[model samples]
Target: MQQQPPTSPDVSSAAKSPLFQSSTQYRNWRFSVEQLKATRAALNQASVAAIRNTFESDSPGSSSDVHFLDANEEHLLVKLYIIKISQLCGHFRFPEEVEATGITYLKRFYLKNTVMDWHPKNVMLTALYLATKTTNHPISLESYTANIPRTNASDVLDLEFLVAQSLAFEFAVWHAHRALWGIWLDIQDLPQAPPHEELQRIHDTAMQHIRTSRLTDVELIYPPSQIALACLSLAHPEIAAFWARSKNADTALEAIESIKRTITRDGDTPSVDVVREIDRHLKICKNPEKVVGSKAYLAKRAREEKEAELKRKKKAENVRKATEQGNPFGEVLVGQANLDDDD
Candidate 1:
């Protein structure tokens, strides 16, 4: 009797959990465009309002002025911080799985708190510490903070619980690495397959794409399987075509397109000027006293202060014109009085 081919396992029962539904349904990890917009807007508004209030309350013509990172600046700073997280993980000799998980934790945490409210450096350290524990590659707090500059055990441990709370203790992160392995295995079983070296190259290239993909919003928008397919598509078009045709070609193609858009949006690579600006701002944010003394910070602050002064003068001029028009509501128009108050 001839041996029979093994049947695929029935995963119907496993489809009932939230993990299975993550690709189709919106989970806590996923964010809509509007949600991202609102979050950034709220952070910017709060920072500006705080700065204005401080300037107004302080003594007249004080040189001290507050500076907050704009949306673009904040985004760049976060990207740099994520890169630092990878470096730190590498220094400790942790596997890529730990690095990916840690970076995801940092990203998700920032979605809840702004860079102003929670410094990215501390959060990055906390996330990595959490990742090491979660991945079963536990490291002592002392050992972890040994080489990291300006950090101690307390810095990591103190924020560890907060980071966990920010993530709602959602430690389970499904990475595209495993999915890439599955695709490689499938390719190996195919007839007329390439030599082992070529197959390894395909696998390596796909892994590289997956690593780069983490620097994008694709992880939040798409599932690991889609990410895996997209990476393979970038690596080997034939493998991607085969994989898509075997599954839902339309859906897979759409996801691949979205990933392509994200990669394009990130651009070929960050320009040197952009990278320098990010570093300058990151240094100021981390060590304001040291960096605020720099000439660049002073020039930037002067420009911002000038803009704020212009806005104030314009507002005053508008109020004066409104009052001269003999409008009873002119005082309220200048935001000086409330019209709703009973006399």
Candidate 2:
């Protein structure tokens, strides 16, 4: 008999080990982080290329009217979007594994699906529902539907099947929050220490940026850890520069030097002093809702009721037509009606 070759351990077993997992997982992740090395890079590159192109081509002079939210506005909306998505992911009955998987799903889905086409809330619900099913998290349709925000709840239920089928049942995901904690702890033990205050800021800001990774195509190609690192690298510049400098004092300036190169290459890096400008922009968006009075809220509700009435009437007409033609179950409808009342 010929000599038998050795059998390797299963992939799942290796994944169970801490050491073999992180690097392997990071390397396997998608999209380039370097694409949006700075705030401006997103404007010119694929980061927001779809929206920018749409506005620019649709009407040559209308780019100004399209309202490209400044970096601060972008950051705020993206951060808020992530929080809601995270909350929805938490509703799933899965363990930490499934929640992590859902976050990745949100990131990947938004990379291609914009806030313009699919509101973040709807997408968030859809991703979580899909994730729960993919991981076999034991959530029932009724339970899931009940937990959704009352506004877009039905729309989410409507698209639940499509999102799940599109994801192809891969529900496993890794998260940056854990990885950021790991990196923070790892850096603390280094021979040359990083400042505690700086590390905390970096961690917080990185988490914020990671939330927006969903707004970019980068999610599909990169691992959560790398996304965290990229965000950290961008958010907390001094820490990264210090680490790079300490590695080779002769090239102590190398880390900072590389940042300069990154800026030059990207051509979209915000000016060196963008933090103040970003802060101002955030204040404007967060100021106040225009509909503050009880009357305004009531009016909004009435408008929504009227819209719903119109939809109901249209649906009745369609259903009557279908029945007259010998169709049943109203099964021919393929589009999801936008129920914007929830937002």
Candidate 3:
């Protein structure tokens, strides 16, 4: 065999190899490198153009002049975020924490980068993988590939390194979910019980809020904690009790408004049309069956229905069994101890 390449004298001392460092040494690496560099350059150019376009219009936030995305484009972008996060959620063994982390990174990455340079799907998987590694679970690239939908596996994997590079390999992301839960708990004065499904729904809704919040400066300025609070505010307005007593609500609300101002000043009151467009794009790229038809989803649904039906059926069953096992008070009262005695 040819001489072996020398290992690092102390394997433990390295700062950890850059992802894809080996691939960079491959013969065709130059082509991939040049392509990525050109892509990054193009994206940077587009970002500049977008900023310039923002200044051209007399009305800052109006749709007439500087716009980030038209209705169709915005919808498409949002949809991509949804699909990416959903798929990541599915892949990393349905770990909600990892899914949340991936979504947070996507939003952050978009704030710095743009839709022009990186496709959302690739960026999404990259975020997921990065999140996984960050959480210390550390699934290998092969496991990711195996979990990915066969059709999109390679494409998703291809973007992993670039995604890492975009985030500068610092992918520690905090979600708004926990912050919201804390607020909810504190305001409600409930004991330290786990959040019920309804509470979980609120968190899920807050997540969607984060997506829309991207249109505002909230993504850029406010911490995730504030964003999570804003999301909770929007999602559970009926919980006036929760907001009224919470001192921090004002701060959270202000962060949201500030984000809205930035977004609007950046362009216009974000059109519902734009939000819808983004939502649609995210949903389309996802495999419906994996989300809706997966065994886990189906099983959960089935269990819920079974439990409900059991409640109804169990009452009757218990009554019937009680009647069978219970003493015959009427017969005892008549002193009919046995058939032979009656005869």
Candidate 4:
């Protein structure tokens, strides 16, 4: 057998674990409080400018009087849709992993994109559809969209690749629910484990908190295991304290406290009215270039197709030059070569 690896003095914190630190979640998706704010604000600003330009170009002075959605409003709208993902999952009888992974994908997509370009309504559906596949919930495309009125297979598929791209194609997510389950199993073997009924209640309550955490920034800020413990701490402080003391994890308890506060502070979804208002503004400010059948979308597609055709023609020219002149890229051969050229 190979030798065991060395660990630090404070090894209880999940964020510091070697396995988790190497995950894409820790490396690519993690962010500080300030960084998350700065990123959203910057993306919102850039999206506003780009959409305004597109509107101006399409219909001069069209967007001059429009009130665009700010970063906070965009976030509220996304939260609204996150809740929708859960409802949809329930409707489809999807597993919690699919729901959670869908939410994570939607969040990651908005980090690198804006709600204006792709409405969260459509993207939420697409993300959940993609999540169903990624999480092994295996619902057919027709079956998935059949019951969702006004949604067709194309509507879900159109943004599927785009969502995948936004997530950097990292579909595997280590979720807090799994961690909480693991912790629950460990709690079973504890010195004075709660009676079966009490332990089950604690597990269920903590699992609810884990679901609530998906509505907050804790998922991006901390590892799943830390979030799980924090949720457990929230559900039943006495049991959490007992578990922590059992493990002699002082620092871990401190971090759990901090994350517990974060979940409590930010976990609740905004009121329906508040989110409804943000969503109302979103329709007016949404990017026309992404709105299918809009003149701007048609124009944008035409331009993209033109550019693609040009690139293809250029490649063909290069191929012809290579075959005829022994050069990868050049004007077509003529003169003596013309005599040998096939009709």
Best by lDDT: 4
Q: What lDDT score goes with residue 162 in model 1?
A: 88
What tens-digit string does per-residue lDDT give for candidate 4 at 273-304? 98888878888999999888999999999999
What local distance difference test score does each model get?
0.73, 0.53, 0.55, 0.88
For model 1 the local lDDT of residue 232 reads 86
lDDT of 2 by residue, 1-343 (tens): 8886776755766677666255533444443455333423453244345554544453465445443445344433444555566666655445655665666676555444334334455666777667776667757667777776574456667666655544544455556657667766766766666578866777787666655554444444444555455666667666655544554443434333433343234323234345345444433322121224534346557778999899878877865676577644344432222323342
User: How many angstroms is residue 46 displaced in model 2 relative to the true structure, after the best TM-score fit?
Assistant: 19
lDDT of 3 at 214: 48
Model 2 lDDT on a 0 to 1 scale: 0.53
Which parts of model 3 have CA positions greater than 4 angstroms off?
A: 1-75, 78-81, 91-93, 111-117, 151-158, 190-217, 238-244, 248-343
TM-score (C-alpha) between model 2 and the true structure: 0.43
Candidate whose TM-score is highest: 4
RMSD of candidates 1 onward, in order? 15.4, 12.3, 26.0, 6.6
Lowest lDDT block of 10, candidate 2: 282-291
> Where is model 4 poorest over a 10-residue stretch in terms of lDDT?
334-343
Model 4: CA > 4 A from native: 1-17, 326-343
lDDT of 1 by residue, 1-343 (tens): 9887885676766766656466322456766556776776777667546544444444344324434567666666677778888788778889988999998898888776666546778889999989988888898888788889888888788788989998888888878887788878877876645899998998898888887887776777777777888888888878777767665575687668777667547624445688677666544343221234654446558878899888878877865787777767655565753343322
Q: What order do candidates take by lDDT, descending?
A: 4, 1, 3, 2
Q: Estimate each model's TM-score.
A: 0.70, 0.43, 0.46, 0.88
